[model samples]
Target: MVARRNWAGNVHYAARRFHEPTSVDELRRLVAGSDRLRAAGTGHSFNRFGDTTGDLVSLAGLPPDVTLDRDRSTVTVPAALRYGDLATALHAQGHALANLASLPHISVAGAVATGTHGSGVRNGNLASAVAALELVTADGDLLTLDRDADGDMFAGAVVSLGALGVVTRVTLDVAPAFTLCQYVRLGLAREALDEALDSAYSVSIFTDWRTPLLREVWVKQHAELPPPPAGWLGTTAAETPRHPVAGLSPEHCTPQLGPPGPWHERLPHFRLGFIPSSGDELQSEYHVPRAAGADALAALDEVAHLIAPVLQVCELRAVAADRLWLSPNHGRDSLAIHFTWVGDAAAVTPVVAAVEERLAPFSPRPHWGKVFGLAPAAVAAAWPRYADFLALMVRLDPSGTFRTDLLDRYFPRP
Candidate 1:
């Protein structure tokens, strides 16, 4: 119980008073009694950001109550609903989320709070799909937020990272459901990221320092026909991003049609799914200005000497720019660079140092879910309105009822 794996494979001190509350009433009581508490969902995060010293809250068992608003084209789901089930439920109602992550196993609340995103040039992160949310704040006070009202909370809640409150339910903007004609291709050199960048709506390449040559690229085109009738869906790994370590880098993985089906298939690389080529690997993802992609790639490569061997894979993804304060792609169209490692995290962390060291001019936004040893000042430096957000948090949770050591890490100094 002390040691558990998050989706990104980071471990830390877990909660002593872990609970799955069935109702707000039970949660209020639990929250009121705890000295230190944190809510966890699927343990899919990369760092101990969810780790707590005294108590942990697991929302997996909560009853899922889903509601659809046909007029507004929105779906409201309990915070605990797995993204997989949420999508399926939404589909049955003749609706689908605006876009979904590659792997749909994550929780809607957790993903949005952390600004989880899938590759897309025009689309936005999952948090953008949120139209409204019900949050239980520090004093166990329930509050509602949306674009039309409580705008400040709405801005903070979109990517709150659990700092503002415990999200209870989320109302997401939905679109007419559709299917994708998927193809995974290899060969987008770290250098060619610019040349081939605009070819697909969503593209992700997996590789590490060992091969500067991009290893795997997932390509998809919207299709009217519902997913190619079984066998025609391309079973063998012969297509793109050929599975089973192709180059000097040996990845322990087998390529199949795609696991976890439609939902989990969205994000095929992360855990609660396939582990990709490297076993027990560590990962780091930094989102930088899209213009700096080439430069960022060059910087990551500079650390190849220290990172080449332990590096299992690196992924490149593009995201449309947005105005969200804490968004990694804030104010600029962005490229997310990922580093997957084959060995020790303590050893591989230096790679992050090198990437950060070289990318100082770019001022990259670190993925909230990955392991990177940058101080809060550095983290907040990437987010301009972080100070305002802190002020807002103080106003809303002045008692610090929702506070944790992790929260202190970000707000304590200020």
Candidate 2:
């Protein structure tokens, strides 16, 4: 049998077999009968969180059903649906999601489960929009959890890390479709980041840490908002489109240079169909308190030499805090420091360790789906409600049929 690797081609899944269930009933049956099983969504995660020693199920073949409730301003979609496709459908129906990750190709369920987020001082992570979800549990019984009525338990369930069950459907809050414009500035000084950081709707600063000067600052704004001065932020506007990673063709990137377009199109750095970021890259992100942005940048700057050797690029963004228990942005507004490293794991691991150590003082939370060097104990300790999440997981799946080594490593049965 062929071994299946993840999107980043890093971890090879150890599943004995892979199955694509065409219907919810088929999915439930396959999962119910298996001693060990886990769901795979679009194969976008960089780690073994989705890997299992038993059956590996994909909901891709499931019907892509989308039901809209215009009165309640919500949309119910199959879990396997990719955000990119969902965004297109939502726009056509005159609705939209508040934010999207840097790449739109990820499955909605996977993105929400991993706490994936987009950049915005006011916007919460994608999971924050999940009003409700349905999952097929170990017994073949379908279970539904609502964010509003489920109370504290729902907060932990939203970011399940593939431990609770096979999520089959997700209901998300929607908003009136809107348009945005993207602007880019090149070679801005590090000091300028403080003054210009929260000045825009959604701001991202991209750099490689090779130099003290930042490489790019992407400013996304509402179409109706006035444009900043041409020489705004003391840097020249990019006359043409620019990719986040230097030397790559800007063709893969969305429209830039102040052109107004659908929010779904302009918000993500890469266009839906194009390869996102560098095709050969490993990602690791750490979120620190929003106010700790300067200290975090300085901490990373001290290790620039160690990082630049294996680094592809580093991205900086902010996310508003939410109530989701497992979300990195929980409790406090955060500044996310992301590293897109060259795909060499051996060379990148030490650098990731150094980064974690440097940011340790601030209690940074690592992105769950990406590569990281922190120990399982440290990760659990960082989340105050982690013990509660573990209890919830055990209560939901006592047999541990849906549990993976990844979850067990970080959250063991208490």
Candidate 3:
């Protein structure tokens, strides 16, 4: 059999067998019979979190089962469905999700499980929108957990990293469809970062760290708001389209230049039809308290010389706090500093470690789906509810059927 690799082609799965079950019954049977298994979603994660030595299952073969409850303001979808497809379905019905990650191509289950997010000071990470989810556990039993009914355990489960079981379905909060306009500004001063971030409904700052000035500032504002000023913070609006990563074609990016568009179209940085980001790249992100945003940038600046060489681009965005135990933005309103590095792991690995070391003072929590060199203990210490999540994992998956080497490292079996 051929090898299976993730979307970035950085990590290869070690599963002895791969299974695609067309029905929940078939998926249950596969889970019950296997000594060990791990569910693979769109394979967008860059790490080994989805790797296993036993069986690997993909839920893409199952029915999408998209259902919207206008009364409850929620939408239920199959776990494997991409956010882009789900957004299209929701928008068609005159509804929309509160927020989406930069790349809408990710699977709902994977994105939620790993605490993926989009840019906005008031927006919570994607997992914060989960209202309920259904999963098949080690015993082949279908279990459903609701945000309101399950309380703390549900909070712990939302960003579970696939340790509890295979999430098959998810119900997310929705809102009336809305529209927004995207604006791109160039050459923002470093000191004006906070004001620029809060200047719009959703904002993204891009820089290569080679200069003191920010290279690009993408502002996404609600359509109802007045147009941005001709010149603010000494930054000029882009005369033409711009890519987050310098020099790349802007064709893949979502519409920009202050034209009003659907929330789904303007909220995400990339268009649904295009491959997100530069496809051949490795990503790493850390969330520090919003109050520490400036300090965090200064910390990263210390290592800018090392980072700029291997980096494609660096983005800084904000995310509101949420209750999800494993989420990087948990407890504290956060400033997410994201790095898009060249695909060469050998060269990029040390830079990642250096970045982590510089940001260690702020107790940064790394995005679970991305590349990071932080030690297991350091990572566990960053999450206050880490122990609670570990206990919840053991109670739900006693036999560890869903366990992977990555999970085992952070959450050791007693």
Candidate 4:
């Protein structure tokens, strides 16, 4: 919509019609006219979730309407609103989201549909925050999806992968905004991964995969009293083992706050405007069982030696269990190991293979946006709900207008 090209450079087949629709009727008209149609949000998804060669319908111009009911403690928002915008608005009303993914720039609707998450022991995927939704089905029918209305559709739409329909609005159960004491410290020797994780509201580790050591650990505590009003934030109650060595590569940095109370900025340590990343950087993340996190990290270490030197970064984090069928957590608490590299995937593809080979014992769920992947059959091993998810997709979008090569790869024709 904005100059045609998106942030990720997802190109269309041709210079097609770009429509910005505010109402469902306008979107329906746009979709009806085009042979192949797809709705796009802020275009934050890294892959082709919004990649349609036909008409591209953007909901950017849609007015943002958020109303909060303190008595019920829920806030309803326009699906097109970015989480960053949503968070700020929510904070103004003394409300906050339960959790937020690393980057706040993504649209809540887009992120929820893809199962976006943040590191936390008590939090679930963003979609799990939904209490209700205003959905526009392909046949131009409007429906409000809720847990009681249609259970399967409700579960599937959470990670619907933008398949079921265009989510126009979302109402979420919110919590009273609380301050977090962000503690960050090097964990050169902290091996208390699971136990330490259990103590904090959220945690993050920035480490080089090549080493057996946890380079650093970041813990966020529930602060009844504001954190030390000076100096850098400290790591949580997790014990950090002593570093026997002087220094590895001397590359360690801490997470910083953009501003307090606004949870969206806190989701990501670095903002696109504050600090720019490599123009050619690529990201791939996988979710493993929380119980298997330690073992998976050990297996990853075996290949870490191969990737350490060439790799940009390896991030370790956790996400709470959720009921959303396609959420990475699915029925189990999840630990995500993420990778960001500087160039073509080929340089890191072999390392990813080594990880997959070693991680066979603990089937890993790959993130939808990033590229490291397995076929549909492989995904079935990671998420048991594949069959149910596929079945719902067929019923909701039998014609496959929302289908793409990526969807087909993860979801073979039934």
Candidate 5:
């Protein structure tokens, strides 16, 4: 037995043992022997979603087997492979993913499991790229689900929260390689951002919530298109590159200033080898339907005083809707409000609660892997397909082998 903590060091996993299997056969054996277990990837999750009392398994030791199907325009990747590494390899082969999150350090399976996303009105969350997956169930049996063969069930399985089983491999759709350029605008007014939100391929607006204007706006545009508008909402285009969080060296960030680069290099904010975001930070995010965005931000502004002292910065982005049952953007186009806090959980919890309460009227859906203060009842009420997801969980893991305190606490089984 050994002790392990999550990437943020905020969650100390309480597993009786930790296992890293080098092969699917070995992984199956571990799953079959444990009555209660959970799988984690790269420890990127901030909370206890990947913790368990019985055993915690990771597939990092397993060989990364990446294959491309030319006829299908898809690539099959090992669950443990991080997006940065996978993107590099795919780029070498003249292929690319649709979008990437702000950081490229997270595991593919872990990110999809928790509904991690990138910013784009036309782009879906990472899970939406999944075309198929292979997982080991409670009985140690391996099952594969393809989007073509299993429709609705596949939607639920992509954002499974590690409840159904340990995901082993994922098949994702790809497109011909492309190039993009990033441009930064300083201090854009709220109305200006609204007008240009859908003007670019991807847009990210950063703020501290203390002012009516946003601090920075990063717009990623296709190399083939014209540049973004200048002098928007009292904000002007930046001649030099800048980090998402003010004062941080732009060297650590991806290339900017309209220089065309490979899609993988320009899509994310931080470069692959550099540290991503403020290292000493806690993250919390909520997704509300796009129509409620204005009201939601207004509500958060009402509590800006409560949020600022504990916050590093806040980011706003939009995500396209998908059919995934548990996805925050499930059924409605979403506006995501994210916070990077000052790393003091005690000082941040109250603020998190206050934000949740203020946005309750919008029925915001919390990010599964991030810090949240929603009560169990509130959580259960947010997802319209919660009951269907619960039923699916039962069918996949009848013995509750993958259940954890995190799941049981918020979504208790009957």
Candidate 6:
């Protein structure tokens, strides 16, 4: 069998066989027959979170049953549906999600399962939008969990990291469609991030960490709100469109320079039709308390020299607190420090360690789907509800049918 690698060509799945079932019945049979199984979606993860030694399944072949409930203000979508497609469909019907990650090509189930997020001081991670979800557990029995009905368990299940079972469908809360405008500021000073984060609906600051000045600040503001000042924070607006990573062509990026557009178009940094970021790159992100944003920056600045050689670009964004058990921004408002590293794992691994060490004082929580070298013990200590999530995992799949090597290492079964 030809080896299947992840989007970044980083993790090659070790599944003995790969299956793509076209219907729910077919998927159920596949899951029931396999002693161990794991489901993959869009292959966007940088690590082995989706890998298994047993059979592997992909839900992409399942029918995208997008159902919208106007009264309830929710949309139940197939797990395999991409965010970009979902956003377009919602906008046509005068609805929209609260926010979107930088890249819209990711599967909704995959993104939410791993606690993926977009930037905004008041916005929660993608998983927080899950009002309900359907998953086929180890016994091939379909189970549905609702945010209001399930209470604490639902919070734990939304960000399961593929441990409980294969999420088949998700019901997400929606809002009235809105418009926003994108603007890019060049050469922003490092200390001005807090002010800038609150200046727009969503903001992303990008830098290479070699200097005190940030490379670019991309702001998405509500069209109804007043526009940002022309020369705010000693920064000048970019005359033309710009990419997050310096020197890369801006053709793949979303429109900039303050033209009003639908929320779907402006919220994400990259256009859905194009590959996001440097396609050949490795990513790592950490969430620290928003209160420590400045101190976290200072900590990393001490190791800037170590990060510069292997770094492509780094991003800083804010995320509001949530109740999700495993979400990085679980208890406190957060500042997500993201790293896009050169594809070379050998060169990047040590740098990542140095970064984790630097941010240790802030009790940083690593992004579940990204590459990180944090020890299992350190990871467990970071999340207040880690043990609760483990209990939920066992309750849903006691046989460990969905467990992978990565899951076993971080959440070892008793």
Measured with C-alpha atoms, the lDDT of residue 320 in candidate 4 is: 84
TM-score of each: 0.86, 0.97, 0.98, 0.87, 0.98, 0.98
Model 4 agreement with the true structure over 184-252: per-residue lDDT tens digits? 555445466776567567777777765566766655666554542332232333233212112422112
Task: Kindly provide the TM-score of model 1 when superposed on the true structure, using C-alpha atoms.
Answer: 0.86
Per-residue lDDT tens digits for candidate 1, residues 133-249, read 887777777888887776755776678777777788899998887655555555445566664557554566666567656666665445443432333222223343344234642
lDDT of 5 at 138: 97
TM-score of 5: 0.98
Task: Quote model 6's TM-score.
Answer: 0.98
For candidate 3, what is the lDDT?
A: 0.92
Worst 10 residues of 5 by lDDT: 1-10
Instruction: lDDT for model 5, please.
Output: 0.90
Q: Alpha-carbon error at 17 in model 4, in Å?
A: 3.1
The C-alpha lDDT values of all candidates are 0.68, 0.89, 0.92, 0.69, 0.90, 0.92
lDDT of 6 by residue, 1-414 (tens): 223878899888888898888998888888888888998888889999889999988898898889999999999999989999999999999999999999999999999999999999999999999999999998888999999999988989999898998899999999999999999988999779899898888999999988899888998999987767878998998999988888889999889998999999999888899886545899999999999999999999889999999998999999999999999989999999999999999999999999999999999999999999899999999999999888888888888899988899999986
As a whole number from 0 to 100, the lDDT of residue 373 in candidate 4 is: 52
Clashes of each: 11, 0, 0, 6, 0, 0
The reply for model 1, stretches above 4 Å from the true place, is 1-9, 224-279
State the displacement of the C-alpha of residue 155, model 6, in Å, after optimal TM-score superposition: 0.7
Residue-pair clash count for candidate 4: 6
Tens-digit per-residue lDDT, 72-106, candidate 3: 89999999999999999999999999898888899
The 10-residue segment of model 3 with minimum total lDDT is 1-10
Cand. 2 TM to true fold: 0.97
